[model samples]
Target: MNDKNSTEPTQPQPPKNNVKGAWNQVCGWMQENLFWTVAYVIALLTTVLVGRELFEGDHSATFREWVLFFLATILFFGAVRFVQIFTSCIREDTQKPGQEGESKEHEILKAKELQKIELQKRSWLIFSYSFMLFALFAALLPFVFDVEQRSAAELSKRPIAVFVGCVDYSTDDEAHSREELRCQLVDSAQSPAPGTQAPKPITSLTQQTSETTPKPGEAKTSDTTDTTKTEYAVITNTTKTMPTDTGIKTEVTREITFHRYSKNGMWIINIGGMVNRCNTDIYCVRGGLSVPLYFVILALFGGAISLTRRIPEYQKQAYPKYIQIDEKRPKLQPNQLREYLVFQIVQFISAPFIAVVAYYLVVPESTVVSVTLGFAAGFASETILLMIRAVMDKLNPSTTRSTQFGSISGYIEHNGQPVKDANIRVIGQQGLEAKSDDSGAFVINSVPPGEHVLEIKHTTGTQSKDVRVNSGQATSCHIKL
Candidate 1:
């Protein structure tokens, strides 16, 4: 009977298959959470419309018009929420289990639910991200398009021209006293009298002495006479006096010049002018790649996080032990290690190249290179985390892998509760294992299908046991470590 039992082939267990049902469950959850989707859509549409009007509408619109526009937007959003709630409730009723061809119906319902959920989620997210992007664009718009004005004052001072001729006069006492005696005769002629002729011009003493010339045969005497004459005259003069203390104070104003293109429903405002000023004040309205690039970068990081979650290491799984063991096995050859190291070096060096490209092609001119460098550094940190996880798994088989070279089972404990992240190994064999998750239970799936001698090594000590494995079937044993 024992030989027959051993000879009979055991049935291969069916592969676990519940993924479709799990997807349906997720879809159902999203269908029930429609409020977030509706709110997001309403907010996004309102922002876009209002932002457009603000940019393009006539400047003549009053504050009251703006208030009314905002109020109407609020009412529209509220109405959308009401409709969303009603439709969502109807969807929930249709999703209940047990109807004709129930499984098929469930699948169909699930598909519809998933579609609605995805539409709402994506629409809302796009709206939100786009609104933020537009707001940033608008805020920076004014800086690019406006012109500046400048003013200045100036003053100058200098001396005016006087006369450019010489004056004649005498200060000698003999000349002045002799001229005074002649002046008395002139004064007598100037006295008021009937039939007074103009006074004869006074002649110098030298002229008077020379007036009598020597006649023919008259005795000639050698005599020389020298006399100087002084002239008195009154001169009119004008003088300019400057203030004792004076200073110049200058005031300057500056403005910038630029152009802007604005749009409203059907109206377009193209304002192009120069702002002039004397001082240093700069104003510019710029529209370029930076704002959009920022949003794109943000989306990229979010996508990275989502991608990380998709990896088996991070995803939730029922039998994580088997997966961890498979991942940690010594599969890489020595050459592969060299390749990996080379890859790491290449990745580390490529960051600067990527930043240079982004600065020139993706980032705006106003953005500093330092900001680009910082972004690159943050990306490098994430890459390092991935590398560390891979490297540690390669180096420590006992700590990181799960396999059954020799079978032994144990319960992990910490302060009387089960401890996770604990290491357990079989002595004198390349047999190593670890617990899965926060639960201290583990199973090693790599051992040969047969009874075997096993030793359990823990942090404190080691214990021995005998275990058996059936082909394709797991054998269970329990111990405290």
Candidate 2:
């Protein structure tokens, strides 16, 4: 019985997380992949050098910080993704068994290839872990790595605040271009008055209302008091009795509720959608401060792909037993997010050009059509990448991009509104006529750089306007008819 038990394989225990052991392993891995490690280091240094200008702009400090954050996130996660892909390929290739009837020389070459591939797998895992941390450090240095706004007071330190509510112009008959929205505030600290401090959160407020009347012709009743608390307004109840001239007594009850607010607690605040950083302000609790939370939400979807299962390998398979361990699958950590981001980047590159090409073929007026085209670019990112690669390969290495032709992009308005389907033509320039979309926007490319007269055609009639196109620059045209 003892011998039989000993011979039977014991189930392997799951590996426990060992930080120190993992650190040592990572050091060894980086040493093995020194060339790739150096390349990543160079990329990190370059990003910091380039990102310095983000701080100098007065355009919008909040917007600039968000840009820096985005760049940092992209670089870090991108490195992680690339490393995973490299490791996956190496692991897959090394696992593959060589042909059964191969020559001696082929076998020797295969052995060398397998050895190189094995080293790659180890090095890539290290690169991903290390670079991901480094990238996070670079991006989070501004905010000190704490993005969560735990309390209303912390909101003062955040960059952006998005105001969402109905416009409150307060007695204005006509709406204007800017926003004057009175949004509910989480903490008054965000938008502070010069001398006032944030009001303390109202923990509790209580009020009660009751009527005292002799039950249809019964006797009078005594006064009573009741107390309870909730988070809202505070109301005071008052009753007054006066002697009547007819020798009868009359009783009256009244209740008044007034608005309560604090600089420290939840209060009504005015925020403009596209308005002021302000002379003074009030900020409510919006998770993640002034940051565009929708963008953050959308970003989560990019890295949400699940990791795929490894292909099952049999014990008696042609591949060596050492490649896999104890019939256990060595799970690769990344879910191909890095490779996916590459696809996204390629699609981003192609989208504008794709839209331009499509516009030339058919000038679409519907925004849905444009959005669908963008979606198509993302969905078929691999195809777009392949096409871009093909174009890059075909282009002459010595050729430089010269502004041989200029473009024109602008809007045609009927009074203040966009004139849809209005045609704008470069007089005597064949195939250069472009029709405006719903927003009165139009783009015309490949127009020769020179002074030209544009003819705008609508239901009413044609109007001519003179414009000059600079080399490789878009000429802005806003026609008010």
Candidate 3:
């Protein structure tokens, strides 16, 4: 029987977390959270590509549709994730008030746990509000500033305009009268630069002289014929060239412009559908903030999103829990929370600047799509990262199951002597009560790690001690009264 027992194999334990160097820790973290790492990498790549595309002013409507649809998909995921977390919090809250037949000590512990859960839920609610605000900002960033003011007639024909200039040149010899017409399609802001007529056409005429000798065995010609064609044709899809002693050059220049809409010019030539370019306005819109309206709109969106999540009836009917939670999840540490908050604040502050830079890169040409898409990408990236961190924390088994709870232990003494019947309690944590033994030794179980206030009450008086706790580790403190 001893041999049989010795031969039996024990179950394998989960891997223990070891202290590692910064690089090693990063590697280990990436290895453990490979899914989230891949997701973040993909999001970064997508954001970069989208930003570049926006900056360059990609004109493909299909690409724009694709980006918008991707943002919509991200919103859907964010909403679902928010609903899941919100439902989890609600379930915990609903379960807390229903615990019955428990002793006073156990009830206190339960109540303390519930209070902690409530704090966490409120934090998450604030996080959701932040996300909603970001989304609102992204959605309205293009229209925050008013467009450049223009006359009704200019606005009516603003998409396409023709600046026509006609010049007549007189020459000697045969009294040649050459008529030259210059037509151009310029931006509304770029038109005629205030009180000025169409741009003066820079015209230059060159004369080429050549002499031809007769072929071999033939007589030389005394007179040279000038066979130059002075009449030039201006056609949309045609080219005319003039040959000179220097080289053959095109006489008429044609530029095909791409715009938001096709345009037909009734002038010397038509410069079809050109870019909806901006000039002085920079954004194609006037630069000035309508701060009140913009903030009010964002507030409305945030309030609506908050109310929808907070109302229990709405949560139950609309955002019902689809996934079941079989076990408790790991709670975030204060340090981890600080890191999260810093990261999110950075993202939020940089989001609009990124969009603005992208817009400026494609200035003189409207970058509305780019700014909106870039903003959306930033918002989505932040929201997705938040969701990933929350989900990863929940799925981390070691922190969730083995170290989900902690304990606190210490001694109560006065004048180097044991103080029996000294009651110790964790402030903000009910049911976490302990009485010192004859040796002044006390122990409290089911206490969470991190900062906590410990209050000791005895015949002497009541005193509070601030303490820090670590997961699965015993924290010792001595109180003197």
lDDT on C-alpha atoms for all candidate structures:
0.37, 0.47, 0.46
Model 2 lDDT tens row, 1-481 = 3775467767999888798799999899889978777767776776676566565666656765776656675675565456545545423242224557879998888788767754654454444444334433442453443343222224334353333222222335223211222333333224557899655554233333443434244334344333322122233444443333343344433332223332222212222223211112322332221222222222222212110111111112222333424323322222222333333434433443443333323333454553444344334434544655676687858658765789988888764788899988886587898999989999999999999878776764446677899887788988865
Model 3 C-alpha lDDT per residue in residues 1-481, reported as the tens digit of each score: 3775566778999776565566798999889867656766665666567656654665755555555555655655554444444434222322223335768998777778767755764565465455656555554643543334443235335443222222222234113211122123243223455777854332222223333333333332232222322122111322344444444444333322222111122121112222122221111211111011222233334333333333332122222232323212212233323334434444544544433332223221223443334434245334434544675687776643555567888888775788899978786686898999999999999898888877676766445677888888888887776
- Positional deviation of 325 in candidate 2, in angstroms? 14
Q: Which ten residues in a row have the lowest lDDT in candidate 3?
A: 281-290
Report the number of the highest-lDDT candidate: 2
Candidate 1 residue lDDT tens string, 33-63: 6666667676778867875776475577666
Model 3: CA > 4 A from native? 1-34, 54-91, 94-108, 144-238, 241-481
Query: Could you tell me how far off, in angstroms, the CA of residue 116 lies in candidate 1 after the best superposition?
Result: 3.5
**True-vs-predicted CA distance for residue 301, candidate 1, Å:** 16
Order by lDDT, highest first: 2, 3, 1
Q: Each candidate's root-mean-square deviation in Å?
A: 36.0, 24.9, 23.6
The deviation in Å at residue 397 for candidate 3 is 54
Candidate 2 wrong stretches, greater than 4 Å: 1-103, 131-182, 185-272, 275-281, 284-481
